[model samples]
Target: MAEAPTDPSHPAAFWDARYAEPGYAYGEEPNAWLVRQSERLPTEGAALVPAAGEGRDAVWLAQRGLRVTAVDLSREGLAKTGRLAASRAVEVETVHADLQDWTWPVEGVDVVALSFVHASPLFRAEMHRRAAGALAPGGLLVIEGFHVGQLVYREVSGGPPRADMLFTADLLREDFAGLEVVELEEAETVLREGIYHDGPAHVVHGVFRKA
Candidate 1:
């Protein structure tokens, strides 16, 4: 079993184990929500994907014509991402780092898409603020993850072990207040990412645009 996030230490082990499994923990396909938001994803310019696992989303974005950089704490996962990118014949820059401490450039990217990156309350807001700061004007941030309501479905869908680490629409609005709310909502949805995340789950998804 993967270790629960004890950040700066445990998360690396946790994710590394998950990715070292027989296949991609979240599958080889891009996130379904990300695919739905593809029309808005920039076909050019730079894109950043933090907490990228197995490079599914990063490779997809690269195939879409973006110069993509994928960041993750697990070297194993990054390696898988590199392999996946090569299999797709696309280029993706991989960075080994923790998003909580990593400093991204201001207005340095045209797109920032994150999926299932559950942050602890201790630095969740600040992390989100940093994500907002990384966006150039008119840049879009597409994100989705288990909502606080996922607690009830935890056994079935599997999300952050701690409720405090889960998100709500209100919390996201407050954290990313600097960005315009293109779409924000909490809803019940079915997940079919991989062996781990498969069930009817409650999630909060949003698309925020920098003005």
Candidate 2:
């Protein structure tokens, strides 16, 4: 967990450089936790995925008959998402924009997937707020991110080094206040996604329904 640069020089540069290389930074498969929660998601509806790098989760949802729109800062990553979606014969609308400034559609989606987004504390709340507001009535919000306890794993965890960026069940509850929480918990799990994220990790998982 290295501290990200304080200067926000289009954070896209940081991610673009990483994604410009061959292979997905977080692997080509959908996150395991997200996969487990997918059973609860609507079979066919619009979904909004923020920080959807390489679009793995978005592609999976699209394949399941959901219309998915994946937003990310990195154009390179979104490009890979396009290729991946094409390979899977699914359609995933890709939007390359900074989450901090991106205008979310008003009650425009049926699901919001926050699979391992790990945004900084400065933007996390706003991001969650927008995600929540973007959801249509009764839409689902699925989240899975490194827990603050993951700090103990240090570099092995491969997430933001700043504790503020890591989450706790309480923090998520607050971030998504107003939503009806159906599931919220923290636990240790093995993550074998890609070269970027693979190890024993402490994480928080949540499922909130827009009231």
Candidate 1 structure quality by residue, lDDT tens digits, 51-140? 898999999999999999999989999999999999999999999998877877699999998899887788788888888999999999
Backbone clashes for every candidate come to 0, 0
Model 2 poorest ten-residue lDDT run: 1-10
lDDT values for all models: 0.88, 0.87
lDDT of 1 at 52: 91
What residue runs in model 2 are displaced by over 4 Å at the alpha carbon? 1-10
Give candidate 1 regions above 4 Å deviation.
1-9
**After aligning candidate 1 to the native by TM-score, how far in Å is the CA of 19 from where it should be?**
0.9
Q: Which candidate wins on lDDT?
A: 1
Query: How high is the lDDT of residue 5 in model 1?
Result: 44
